[model samples]
Target chain A: MNLGSLLDFTYLSFIDACKHSLYPYLPKRRSIQSDRVHLEAAVSWLMKSIDKVDGNGSSKAYRILNGWMPPYPETSGYIIETLLNLQDHYGDGKFFQAASKIGDWEISIQLEHGGFVGREIGVLSRPVIFNTGMVLLGLNALFDRTREKRYLDAGIRAGQFLVECLDENGCFVRNLHDHLIHTYNVRAAWALIQLGLLSGSRDFIEAGRKNVEWSLGQQLENGYFLHNHFRKGQKALTHSIGYVMRGILEAYLLLGEKRYLDCLKKTADKFVAIYGIRRRLVSELDENWKEVSSHLCLTGYAQIALNLLKLFKITKEERYLNTALHLIDDVKLQQPLNRRSEYFGGIKGSFPVYGRYAPLQFPNWAAKFFIDALLLKIEVMRDYENSLIDKLSLGRQ
Target chain B: MQELAKHHEVFAVFGKKGIWDHLDTYLRRRNEIDVHRRHTLAPLLPASHNAHAFPGPVNTLRFLRRLGIPCYKVSHLNGAASVDLLKRLKPDYGIAAVDHMLLPAVIDCFPTLLNAHYGNLPQVKGRDATEWSILLHDHLNVCLHEIVERMDAGRIYLKENIAVDKGDDFEILRAKCQDAAKSLYLRFFERPEECKNLYESNEDGKNYYLMNWELKALAQKKVERR
Candidate 1:
């Protein structure tokens, strides 16, 4: 299927599934246990979706979830969601306390103008655009949850900061040498969409829309986004393609624009056709369709693709939903311990230290993806409480 | 004593940089004074006999001679030479400063050897002394310990535990330690018997660590605590 069709299918399915699962849980509803189970599962699946991409102890995603130092805003979003779910189910305040602790840290790190100073990159310690965008999204989620003026204000500031980073044509200028404009643009767009939607700001929304439009215009006739601007080339890579898909989809969601959604569908269709839905199913599969690859970079892309699939489902697209299911199944098959494992619910990338390619090490980002993927899967399947309890038990085991 | 003067010799080894260079110039001036006094002064050149080669062994031999004993420069010690020089010098005592390797027990058999360590005798005794000290953020308690069978466990000739300022780096601390070593050396040489009696017993409780990730972790923890 083409990228557009697949995304359309995925988005439709996601919305339908979420609405279907959530309806029974609405206030004054019966079957509270069933609703709770479903809600927990959905959150778990979301957590797992992000967890699988965690690298070896570095990355913004991982630090938020696990680091001893100040937690990242993005990771705090997941924490808050988990805490809220627990509070809803068990009426426990401890979860609220934990969430508040992280929330406070997030608030403190928000720069005066609204976004965080990008954490130093790895050991080299450089700031970059991607991290800034990730942080903004996290803060935006926090604002949505708390309705705190500070968080919302910080979110607006961060949104503005990201907007200021865009060039005249609304395209991001970072990673120019790699010529991966489409990739960075998508993240930038995603952040903007969150800002625009949450803050009810047209500028942020327009900025995101422009970014998506520019990205769509740059798509090659062959469906692959161009790479390496210096050489002026084009080749489809799962990673960049996933980023672009996410951006376009998020832009469509934020604006509820059929045109943006149509463009996103097209991109998603192209991505599925190029990579093949079947081949894209497995987490760490190789370019040649081999199963033995051991690198984190490509595996991380796979996790992103899975996330995009989840987004497609929300948009009520069946093709996207089917593709996501197929991919999830493929990933499950490749993960040997999935049969007995609860913690390994999300997608995983290569971790060099553990001698497993796309290894599930304790890096911040990898853990975040792992948690995200698991949460998303659980939410869809409505088995979160059991899975979470299972995971906690596994930890003890 | 006159016969011993003819048969034995004492030489001082000095580097070409830092305070050592000044000491070398001062020694040359001292040699001039000796010449005017009609007394022959020992050679003031580096330990290396060959100008083109490093004088590590020559330096070692020169330090050996400074133990208030008479010793003639061996052929190997005469020029840029090899370990064979150890056999030729065949002295009663050997002393080393920043030499490349620890002298083997067989080599030490020829003479009682001493080394000038830049760290406190029982504490910071190893290579990269100053770097380790600053990284550990240990107060600058440096000393010149005599080298024996066990590395820095040898006799302590002199020690000075100077207070390190918060902003002090390794280079600055090293310079201070060098000055302390020079002054301490002068005092020790002035009364060798008194210096020998000042040696205290070394306890084995102190740890000698190898640099690794654990040390890096420890340093991070220390910073966090601060």
Candidate 2:
């Protein structure tokens, strides 16, 4: 590290020390531990947030506690998955229609080269591999819901673009959001893996697996991934952390690779260690698997909770469920209730409404991940409770 | 265990990270802290060491959970989750048996977290105590102590001494220490009502860390000579 970099770190440390000293004196406001999110409130947030989207057709942030902003396609695509899932879980046609509209919007904005842009309206609309993957996920789910050939065609084309971008080692060498490689592209790789399985394209599956293999190489012995965020050597947002974890976790689920599952378990174990029991989770972590920031990343919290819950299903370890329940309840507490504003049901980027990564704004993807976590919790609890009942019945039998 | 089950429900059991994880961390930390600043503290670890080949921690936790005890996978002995789960269980007594140092919350929570140290109290009170005791040729005492903020500095619950065999090598000393720990627990728990938290303090003892290889070799030589 250069002298400038050293000084930068020292300055940040000094400021952090000041923040810690002053934090206790300040009056805490907008506490996240307000109330647990009910099913109705969560769904309401999703539908309301969707309605708040701009002409580009993604959920717009209800800014200044009032109006909407430009629709974020990155999150809009994920919101489609959550909506489709809710539609299936609740058997509601409105959610399906809503999901279809968003999916169509994502499809409409997709570039002629079969990729999506990070920002649909403002930016130059250059192809971003991660954005394209998110859209591909939405398109794939749309096809599953409607059995539409257009959605399938769109998803396949997107998968092909990703496959074309893959280098010999299965990395998406082309079209990274920035020049820096993101380890979290495992999610994008997992998307292609899904497309491969769905479309029966062995080549697509091979590309995804190679990417996963490369991802495995990047993992630290302590279960943390290297080169995770845009910055080379700084703390990673839990958002990227979750992205990488979920991708690997889902890949294991799809392929049933013991090696993938083993890696996921190791990483999950580290998170459990750092977070402890029901202690509040932070937004970012350093390379040492230590919390660097105290702010809560609502999406990352939910994402990790879901991952741990899934591991509980597979591993049947009570610890996973216990920690997962704590996180689920924590995020559920963040979902606003009994409010006239659109913010009421929407998950925020950070718990205090002011932190890095979309500070003071309710990102649409946060709500998307929140819904996914909530639904997964319900399903996991149902299965867990059923198993207990089954054992009781068996004992009597 | 069956006797304890007969008297009171052993509601929960806790295991820290699996043995394989411990092995990995042990090697990694050793590599990190070197005599020279160059992180060359890496040891020639056995290539065959794997969780699958040695399913010690996983298997034990499984048996515990199957026996209707809620076995938790904790980060460390004093991990917050362990305490949270313990609070939920609300057991009459909390037993600390894992390898990690007990955190303050865990120590303060139960007020009487029973732990069995495989070394003499006030002498062998820290890591690798048994090996240290064997090296020092101190009384091979397996003392049941309460886990406190200071490692193994808690009040003594019970103490019993074992005569080291004439040919007691490192391996033999380890078995003797473990057997002594098991015996102490069985004896203490035999009359549950009689066993109470005697909040009595003991004299300060030296804390042990990783033993030097040279010292270990010398200890082995002394044992052979004897």
Candidate 3:
């Protein structure tokens, strides 16, 4: 380690040690031994968390052990997409209303540069590529759902900023607010792909493709990608790692590339090797792909499970389906079925409640991805069964 | 390893010795490890001569068994009988796993040996490498190298530099190194010849040993300091 990294690691470790001392009574993790899937309640907890935002336009996030945080524009923007999808899937207009409010609040915070500020509501934050691209995804979804001109226009500005940040290698090489380049931008790339197609911008589409193409270079043979840095280099939380994996899978969904799917399968299979028919998934891994931490990243488990289900749908692989089913079963069991607190349905950053990722907090993105995975499970299962039904009907005819 | 197994016929050779860093968790049963230790944690644990390998290897063998691959447990991997078994199997290649160390006889038993080393050679060689990398503050690497006479001093097939980041402890760094090694090994097998030109000879490179517990705690404290 250089002097710079040495100091950085030392500082992070000190703060973490302090936190453990400070919160001795904090639960190590939320248990998921039960078999109940709390889809509605999880959504309710997220909304309740969002509604708990005090003296702000929206609740930034909910700490599993604490209360609500100041409104976070980045998450609030993306949560819009989740809420809209929930509305469409369940035919509940209430979701639409809540999403529109968040959408409007997201639009209200757009910077003069078309990017939204980072962190919670009170700081004087600058534009970040990942955050801006996330907001763009929400805006694009809002435009698609409601055909709102304001959402479309804000999304256009965000897309333009993203386009400006692109380098020749297809990476958003600028405006990281640090020296690190993240593979999680694969999710942002998924958003940009959506925006490009939605707005009919070829440049945006090409940028998304190039970003993914470059990301492929980061994949290690053990079925992992590098550049998973999130605030301390070299280490990555499975949650963000899942984000990149899902993002690449999403990219394959949009682009129809065999390489993308192949990569996704390879990575997913590695997880199956670890989970081995849905065993416990710890939050962190080292350079060698061994379990680094014992606590699970609930959101990552759900996201990866969702990807497995998606793959199973296409390939009809029982291992993929079986692993995904068991994985979801685990998450559902972990969901707070009867907790009186606001965390009643929220998925945590780390299982056992206090591992690093969110450190006893519930970010909106976790709930959002959980919702996506659950809803996706229902959709893919229905589609698969329907395909069988269609085949039967065709054969009868 | 499964990826490699999927492409070619694979067999496993087990060393009799079991290295459990935790004394409290030692196996009283001899069914697991190829060798049976007479020592027992007794009373708090149990006194059983039969021990099986750790859950990872056992579970893996179970999975592989379902796929129709047979595993042979032996006292010495490089022993004459084991060598005869390898010669009889006439396997094209062998993938040495994380826990087992191949003796010169065992390694040379096969025509070619593909071993995954947790540390980059020439700079880092030998056991407890994750600790050494952090102690020396060198960039951590996971590598696939062709086995030569000297340990970790082999023809480097491929390697990837991994970050030993903030808040990482022994387990975390070890896991990352293991993950990287698994990945690099698979990639090396993807096109075995692609790594032919990447060799570097480090006949006199320094080798590392396991750090003492006191040194480890200090280094861990340094890495985890906020």
- Model 3 agreement with the true structure over B129-214: per-residue lDDT tens digits: 66656545436777777776666787777878877667765655555666677778778777777676666666665544434333
Candidate 2 accuracy as TM-score:
0.62
What interface RMSD do all candidates show, one decimal each? 31.9, 21.5, 23.5
Maximum-TM-score candidate: 2
What are the lDDT figures for the candidates, one per model?
A: 0.48, 0.70, 0.69
Q: Which stretches of candidate 2 lie over 4 Å from their true place?
A: A1-37, A54-56, B1-226
Going through the candidates in order, their DockQ values are 0.00, 0.02, 0.02
The DockQ assigned to candidate 3 is 0.02
lDDT of 2 by residue, A337-389 (tens): 75764467777677655566666566677777777877887787667656655
How is the predicted docking of candidate 1 categorized under the CAPRI scheme?
Answer: incorrect
Q: Per-candidate TM-score, first chain only?
A: 0.61, 0.88, 0.85
Error of 2 at A214 (Å): 0.7
Ranked by TM-score, the better of candidates 1 and 2 is 2
